[model samples]
Target chain A: MTALPPPSAKKLGLVIDLDTCVGCHACVVSCKEWNSQSPLGAPLADLDAYGAAPEGTFLNRVHSFEVTREAGPPVVVHFPKSCLHCEDAPCVTVCPTGASYKRAEDGIVLVNEDICIGCGLCAWACPYGAREMDGAERVMKKCTLCVDRIYNETLPEPDRVPACVKSCPAGARHFGDLGDEDSAVSRLVAEREGFALMPDQGTKPVNRYLPPRPRDALPEFDVLAPYLEPVTEGAGGFLGWLDRTLGKI
Target chain B: MHPAPSLILFTVLSGLGFGLMVWLGFGALVPLGWVGFVFWALAYGLAGGGLLAATFHLGHPERAWRALSQWRTSWLSREGVLSIVTFAVMAPHAAGSVFLDRPLPVLGALGGGLALLTVFSTAMIYAQLRSVPRWHHWTTPAVFMLAALAGGGLLAGQVAAAGPLFALLAVALALHWHMGDRRFAAGPDTAESATGLGRIGKVRLLAPPHTGRNYLLREMVHVVGRKHAARLRLIALAAGAVVPAVLLVALPAGHLLGALAVLLHLAGMLAARWLFFAEAEHVVGLYYGRR
Candidate 1:
């Protein structure tokens, strides 16, 4: 059951834009709010919520990095990390119980909480650290891509996307079938040159992160004073020179 | 990795137990009377006790039986299945030797082969984890097998074979630990590669998502200081392999000396297993800028 299904024609995934993300934790919160109450990982455990070290299971997290470019200004890139839902997900394969599985229909990796023994092997197998152990429930939890919300007929079509994608204030997150080249997300990846987190790992992650755009150089101009110029010629006094110049003109 | 005490104990104890079973199956150094019964009990106790301890580490120990269902793809499941099979095969072999007063050569050979396979499967559990580069090596399995043979030989009263076995274990441990240390020192994956930010420049973590420890950090972001790690490595090598080899060579195979060698080797292997888990670097660490 852990063996991956044959390549699906429709690989549903997310595309995150690094250029547009402002590191505002809107998506992270929205994802928690929705999934915590949903069936995938209901009531995501929060240990010592009001204490010195409040720990909780989170499906999505935002990390900020300062990249010091060679001979260029250091760029602070806010990276949002989540489940890549790899095509060859090791987390799925390593599960001793058949609880962790990938959906052949869409390639979304999920854990069957009813069957999971909570051995913590799946978390160890995941390179992205996407899966977290829910302390109270004692089961592995991760991003479900808001499967409940995305598939619900009661909600409007616009609200059918993942909670993270909908709540992103910077419009950094995009969701669609990545397998189809003509899909919106796939086209965006093509145009933006999106890339996987660790291609060397060979996870074949479905999601892609579009790197930040190249920083532009400053233009040749004095920003402080564009109109002012020093007087070059005034042989006589200021008034005499002005009158002479007026007469000559 | 967190290097949980339960897991360290599990690998070390089970390795020693299964290793003894392998030697017994080959009819090596096995005594003719009450001593053989005692040795069988010791092997089973170590293997069974180690397995029991592993279940305690699980969040749902009551559901541990469910783990045996996915043997085809999962190394953990395969280990579970093979362990049970080894026990079944060895039990009959033990009964024949103890109750019937005859050694079942065929059964012993089968059980011994299965016992070694279980250890191999156990090693694969770590080695197959591509997430942890330190564990993802051939040396991991080699060290595991050597440790089993060395420690198990001492337990089985095969002091003559113990010398060479201990030497092999020392070499394997040294090679594995040295390589693992070098791998950690030379950062393979970086924050830049993790986030695809290398094209831009050198990426460093300015701030983590949270100030407090999260599940990921608690479970995967284990960092041991360089000085402490070096010191522990020396301890593991000296206690686990060197001391046992010296004792086995110096003293004849008496009850007192054999007991001392077995205890010392077990202690050493425990240290080695601890280091094995403590030093593993998970790729997720890159996101936290700790790789």
Candidate 2:
């Protein structure tokens, strides 16, 4: 007889405040550092480390976007993207080897690398592009929500949070058991108008982002342009000629 | 929807195996001589290789037998069952053709039906994956049918002994090719309405989440260059369908021309099969910043 999954525990989740994020990319680096040494092996891969085509680690990435409002200063939104640990989790059901699965306890989606045949189907099933294949291991890898740190008894109580949450300089990242009505994440969801990325697909992602506050007025682009350093120089003129010759302004 | 090489090989090879079986069975029913025996042998060889290729795609080959149980909900299961049946039928028919004085036409027809069913089932596997808007259509089955007809025509032309069979294969190939072209032209309905956004506005990707390549980008958002795809399509049409038809008409005069046509047709079919996977756009791709 098929065994039933254990009754799910309060879903642990995150609520990111986009308004406060500084786009420092500290979370990206910290996530890589934490997951790189985990039992599942490195979730991130570096290519051409010191060569011409230098590339960094994977796991999570911070994307910086400048959103222009009709009126006000341009808001720089730092979007940190990672596995949302969705409830529906198509990546789990689509796995031909049953290697990718969602934990019944906290709704954390994970991959059992040992059982993975590396067919790469689970990666296709995910709309979020959260999964990445580890070239060295020949298996799929992703964010594990710092499962080792969060559960380890030796770690200090405050440091048990996920690497990204722990390292957020602006206190933009929040982590808690979302299933509890009184949990910090649940309270934030009730008070703030948080939105899920691409919610139509209905993956029921646990992570939520607080939308940036509306701008009342537009920024003066012409005035700001002069103050900002010139990114590229003109083709001809004394300054341009000097820049061309020197390869710098 | 990204047609892996294993799947492409499986579908095309199986289609040829099944199509040849159908033609050979029909010939036997008409009381044709050695022509039927030649087709039966070819069918056995192709079907065997196709089945073996399919096994390589499985993650757990030991548990492959479990796949046969889920036919009620899985086209893949039905394909597995039908492929096995096709092989079981082909073995006896091949034995009779080689050793026995008389070939059983009725038994051959049964085996041929089973093989054809397997091909149709394989086509349905892609057609049923609702996540891929490109594959989830009637055109998918049309492509499978065309592949079989074109492959069968090429095989019939090579044998030379089956004159009427060659003519039928050519006609079927023409019909399938026409249908496939129409389907390929009618691309997926990936409008904003399909994505469930009621607002009327042009949505574009302002920023993607990650900098490095991810599985979704690599698998779902595959973009083949338009000019390259067009060139390949032309090659596939000429080599897979047109050349085989021309060879069928000229087979009586020159045997080498017929042989050359089969080789060209195989290459063309392989190209077409590659495009079939490469060109398909999954609905999940829309979520990953694809316009």
Candidate 3:
């Protein structure tokens, strides 16, 4: 079962727009909240909760980086990372126990906790650091793409998406069948020029991140100009004479 | 990358155990009756003890049996299966040597071959991990095999064979170290590619995903001081290969000296194994601005 099933035609994935994300951590909060209560996945473990050191397992995380461009001021990019649901997910193939597997139907990767020995090889195999070992349950946990919600007949159509996507205030997170070129998410990816993280790894991640748009440059200004401007423009002042002499020279 | 004690012991002890079995299977110093039983006991003790240590590293040891079911794809599973097969095939020979004072040459050779394959499978567990560039090279398995041969030779009291085997191990270890130091930097992975934001210029982690350390950082990101590591490498080489090889070739084979050599070799192997896990740099660390 660890051997990957043949590639599925319907590649369900997410596209995140970096230009709009505010690094609010709302998705992180909502993810923890929903997954803890949802019947689909096991509860995320938080050891030493309400204590000095609270370590827990989370399916998704947001990391912010300061990027300095050659032409503009440095900008901060907030990167939200989770299971990319790669076409050749290394985590699945490396699993000693067949607990980790990928769905043949939609290409979604998942972990069957019942058979997992928690050897932690799947986590080590992952280049993206997407898998986490639960502190209390001691089982491998990952972003299931909200398998329970994505196809639940009981939920409303709008609520079928993953919790993080549904709760994102900036609308940075978008999800749909990326295999379909005409799908809205696919079109959005094309328009924004979305890219895969660590393409060199060859996992062929299904998810994409839209790079930040170019910023409009502001006019150059000096803080001390006002104080120096009045003196320089004046009436027989030393600075005025100096400027005039330099101009004449 | 945390250099867990259980794993270090597992690899070192098992490597020595299986290595001795190879020489013994080939009919070297085939002690009969009680002596044979004692020799086999030591080999089984080290190998079985190391295997037990490895299980302690698992989160669910009770479910460890499931690991054997996925041998088709997983190296870890292959190691499990091979270990079982090697032990089973080697059983009759071990029993015959101890109980009947006889050497079952055919069964012994097959088990010995399987034992070597099992060691190779164990090494592949680390070698196959592309995520950790330091352990991804062919040299990784080569080093493991060299160490096993030399250690096994010494443990089996094959002094004639020990000199050359230890020499090869020393050379391989040095070459592996030289290659491993440059692997990550030479490879395509970098902080820029990891985040896919390098087109802008330089990308650095301005704010981390969380304030507290997570499992990834704890398990994968570990660094050892350059001076300390260098000192340990020299010590490992001297104690593991040079000294033992010297003692075997230059001095008379006496009980006290042989015991001392084995102990020194064990200490060296332990240091080397610890460095193996500690020095490995996982690519995931790039996201955290770490090596």
Candidate 4:
């Protein structure tokens, strides 16, 4: 059962725009907040709360890096990463138990905690570090793509999306069927030139990331230089007279 | 990767156990009656005990039986299935030797082949992981097989065979280390490639995702000190192979000397196995900028 299902046409995935992401960690917070209570999987572990080392599990995480470019001083890129739901998901095949599987219907990778032996081999097999082991429950937890919410009939149509996507304040995370070339997410990916992370890894990740847009360099002369420059040759009016008197003394 | 003591004991002990089984099945030295019982018992105790140790590291030890169902894709699963099959095939053969003092060559040979296959499958579990460049190589299996063979030879009292095997194992271990040490840099994956920021320029971690550590960091981002690793490698080679080889070749073969050699070899193997896990650099660490 760990063997991956035949390729599915519906590649339900996310497209993140790096240009718009501010690295606020709202998606991370939202993901943890929702998945913890969603009843879809085991609750994320939060060990040693309020102690010296507080540890917890989060499916989605936002990492900010300083990319040094030849033209600019340096670019700050906020990278929000999660499970890509890879077409050739190594995590799926490497699983000793049948718990790890990719959906033939949607191409979303999921871990069934009930059967998961939590050997941690799947986590090791994953190149992206998307899975986390819950300390208390001792089960592997990963981004479920909010399967509970996405299919819920009680919620409004607009609200039926991944928790991270719905809660992203910057509107950077877009979720849709990426396999359809005409889908909104796919169009955005095409227009923005979105790319998969570590393409050479051969995971063929369904989710894509839009590279940071080009930024203008700062002016060569400081804008505050004019204000700091002297208004007059010496001190203005009274200060000039006082200076002359002080010099005479 | 984080080298848990349970896993170390599992790999080292089980490998030694299975290695001894290989020689026993090949009709290396089958003692008569009760003596044969003790040898077979030792092999089972080490292998079975080591297997039990593996479950200690799992999150759900009770569900480990489920691991046997996925041999189609998983090497870990294959190892589980193959190990059970090896035991079943060899059990009767071992029983015959212990009770009747007659070794069944055909059944024992089949069981021996299965045992070696199980070890290979175990090696494949790590070697198949492309995420760890050092482990994802042909040398991984070679080193594993050589180590298992050498260790097994020592336990089986194949004194003449142990010396040559230890030498070969030493060379293989050194080669694995020498090649594996440079593999990370040689691989296409890097901090830049992982981030997909290489197109723009060089990438560096200005700040991590969180101030606190996560499971990934705890499990996969283990770093061993350079000097300490070097010292341990020398110790592993000396104690595991060199010393054992020298003992078996130079000194007259006696029970005490053989026991000392085996003990020293086990110690050396323990250190080498420790390094095998501790030194492996997972590609995932590039995201945290730790590897």
Candidate 5:
């Protein structure tokens, strides 16, 4: 009789700090570079290269938005969007084939690309729109959480991290064993408030975003600078020009 | 959600195939005895083949057996189990019709019920997917029932010698038409409400997340023009239901007209099934820049 493998502990996940992110897009580039050469096959690409509409492949994208505050300067929120690897992954369940499966040990959702027929049902099932079908390969592709790099035994212990986390210039991205209660990510979750995007769907996304700090402390003069610039320019220019032309001390 | 051509063909073709089987099998049950047994076998075989062909659309046909394991939670599993049961019932029924001296009416009735149940299970598979709001309605089951009733009725009218059965088929055609009309009328309002932003306000996509078209847009945002859909619906209703009804009424004069009606009804049913998928709007459509 064959013996079954021992059941593993809880699945580890990620918690990103959106508050400190400066939208450098280094994480996006790093994610593409790492996944492109992985065993899972490349999902990103450069399309219409050397043309007017050239674009490159990216698994993660940083989006910048200006949120107008009531009493301060507009807060610029930088959002990094990628797969959350939810517990109730619709993408996996809706698959007619067993190509998509959530890891029993880590809860990291992965695709067995070899078995995928590229029928695209998994893409439809995802509300977050995380999975993208590689038009060239004719298979669905998504963020793998840098599984290969994170677990590689050949690499030095300190260097063993997701490419996105390593490349984040602003220290916005953090990767650790979220399943462990005393891990850095878990402690960060406890110290700061974190929220999942579209929590109403109840997919139980693993990734979390720390809210941007309030902009109330900024000076009122700085807030009014853009609106008051024209009025100040008219007065200052005329007075300065008159003084300059007359050679007044 | 990205309507695979193979799947669309499978569902529509099988709907007609199984629908025809139900009518023929039921005919064999009611007083007709062994007269319509050959037609019943043909219908069952066609429906079985259509259902089997649908499995080709799956990624792993080897794992297809596993689908039957989840009948407790999945309608898809129920459909698979019911389809197999239908086939099992059909084999014995077909063997009896061809080989046995005496027709087994009880077996015929049981087979007929199983065939109908198979179709119901297939319909319920779609009807139960709450994520696809358009499919999760009474209309889904109603349409499947209508397809079976109409197709079966048309087949029965063609093969059976009994004139009263033709009148019964006429009633089924009328009911199919009525239900089809009602189904189409219950349009995209539920979808609008599900988004939680629209009652009477105009909502439009100002900017999409990306310039390149992705799977979500391709799958959910398929739009058919209203004018064309309306025209097709009318044609299908007339050819599938009204024309068949007229033929059934005229069957007393000549059986050839009944045969013509069956062909017309099949064509109409195919068109109607096409429109069924074409007109359906998934709630995911809202995310794909459609309101």
Candidate 6:
């Protein structure tokens, strides 16, 4: 079962706008809250819940970086990373137990906890660090794209996306069939030039991140005008200049 | 990239066991009568015990049998299947040699070949991982194969064969170290590429994903000091290859020399295996600016 199926026509994926993400960690929290109650890798236990240096498995994480250009104002780029649901997901192929697999219907990658030995090879195979080994549950955990929620008919249509996508306050996350050229997510990708995390790795990730648009230059300000005026005065000798500069200031 | 001690021991001990089995297959060091049992016992003990130790690393050892079901794609599954086949084939070969006091040449050769294949499969488990550039190279499996040959030769009491095998091991180890260090220094991937922020300028870590050490960082972000790693590499080379080769070539064939050589070589192999894991640079480390 680890042998990948032929590429599916409906490539369901997420497109994240890096420009609008505020590094609020809300998506991470929402993902945790929803998945902790799901069938697989449930009750994602924290080794030290209330103690110092709490550690646990998470399906998604936000990393903040300070990008400094030599001439422009520094900008903080917040990157939200998760399972890309790759066309050739290494995590799926490297699983020894056939527990990690990709759906042939919609290209959603998932882990079957029933057969997982939790040897941690899938996690090591992942270049994006999207897979997490849930030690307490004894299985590998990953972003399922909320298969349970998305397909559940009981939930209202507006509330039927992945928890992270539905809860994002900044509306940075978008989900739809990317295989459709005219889909909103596909159009966004086309317009914004969304990119994969490491294209050279050949994962061909379904999820994309739109880069932050280039910032405009700051407005001009005469910060030194008041201090410079007295030093250039007409009466200037060393002492006169010093007195004027001191008195004027 | 965390150098789990069990895995280091697993590769070293298993390689030594399977290597000795190869020698026994070729009648290179065939002991007669009752003594043959001790030899086969030691070989199977090291290989089987090492494999058992590896299972301890799994989160659910009870479900470890499920690992064999996915051999079509996974190197880990291939390793599992090959290990089982190697043991099944080698068992009868060991029985004929010990119980019948005779060598089954054809059967022994098949078992020996499978043993070698199992070792290659084990190496491929790491070699196939593109996520860790340090381990994803031809040199990884080559190094594993060479170490098995060299260590097996010494353990099988083939002093003459040990000399040349150890020499090849020395050259291979040096090349592996040189390439691994250079790759770490200037590989293609970087933090900028990881985040797709290279167009902006240099990217620096402003804030980590969390204040605490998460599972990803704990398992994949291990860092070793450059100076210490260099020193360890030298020690591994000397103890594993140079000293063993020199002793085997210059000294008389005696129990003391053989025992001393095997012990030192094992220590060296352990160090090298530890470095193999500890020094690996996982691509995920780029996100945390660990690269």
Model 3: DockQ vs. true structure: 0.81
Q: What 10-residue stretch in candidate 4 chain B is worst by lDDT?
A: B218-227
Per-candidate Cα lDDT values, in order, are 0.88, 0.66, 0.89, 0.92, 0.63, 0.88
Q: How do the candidates score on chain B by TM-score? A: 0.96, 0.81, 0.97, 0.98, 0.78, 0.96
The lowest-lDDT stretch of 10 consecutive residues in candidate 1 chain B is B181-190
lDDT of 6 by residue, B28-77 (tens): 87775678898998888888888888898888899999999999999889
Which regions in candidate 2 have their CA more than 4 angstroms from the true location?
A: A1-10, A41-44, A54-57, A65-76, A179-182, A216-249, B1-10, B18-41, B44-132, B149-218, B242-261, B282-291
lDDT of 2 by residue, B49-115 (tens): 7877776765545555655644544466678778887777766665676567466667777877776
lDDT of 1 by residue, B140-167 (tens): 9999999998888988888988888898
lDDT of 3 by residue, A94-173 (tens): 99999999999999999999899988999999999999998888889999888888999899999999999999999999
What is candidate 5's CAPRI-style docking category based on DockQ?
Answer: incorrect
Ranking under DockQ, best-scoring first?
3, 4, 6, 1, 5, 2
lDDT digits (tens) for residues B1-291 of candidate 4 = 998999999988989989999999888987669889889998898889889999999999999999999999999999999999999999989999999877898999999999999889989999999999999998899888888888899889999998999999999899999999999999999888898889899999888999998899989998855459999999999998999999999999999999999899899989999999999999989999887
B214-286, model 5: which lDDT tens digit per residue? Answer: 5555656667453487787777777766666666655564557766777787677666666656665555554
User: What local lDDT score does residue B83 receive in model 3, on the 0 to 100 scale?
Assistant: 83
DockQ of each candidate relative to the true complex:
0.73, 0.11, 0.81, 0.80, 0.12, 0.76
B186 Cα displacement, candidate 4 (Å): 0.7
- Which number leads on lDDT? 4
Which regions of candidate 1 fall more than 4 Å away from where they truly are? A221-249, B184-188, B224-226
- Report the alpha-carbon TM-score of model 3 versus the true structure: 0.94
Q: lDDT by residue for model 3 over B1-291, one digit each (tens)?
A: 788899999999998888878777777767668988888888888888888899999989999899999999999999889888888888889999999988798888888888788889889999999999989998888878878778887878888888788888888888778999999999999899998899877989988899887899888887645448888899988998888988988999877887888998899989888888988999999999987
Measured against the true chain A, the candidates' chain A TM-scores are 0.89, 0.80, 0.88, 0.88, 0.80, 0.88
What proportion of the real contacts between chains A and B does each prediction keep? 0.84, 0.11, 0.91, 0.87, 0.07, 0.88
lDDT of 1 by residue, A1-249 (tens): 776788787789999999999999999899888987885655888899998878888899999999999976899999999999899999999999998999999999888888888889999999899999897888888888788888899999999999999999999999999999999999999999999988877789999999899889887687767456555545578877887889898
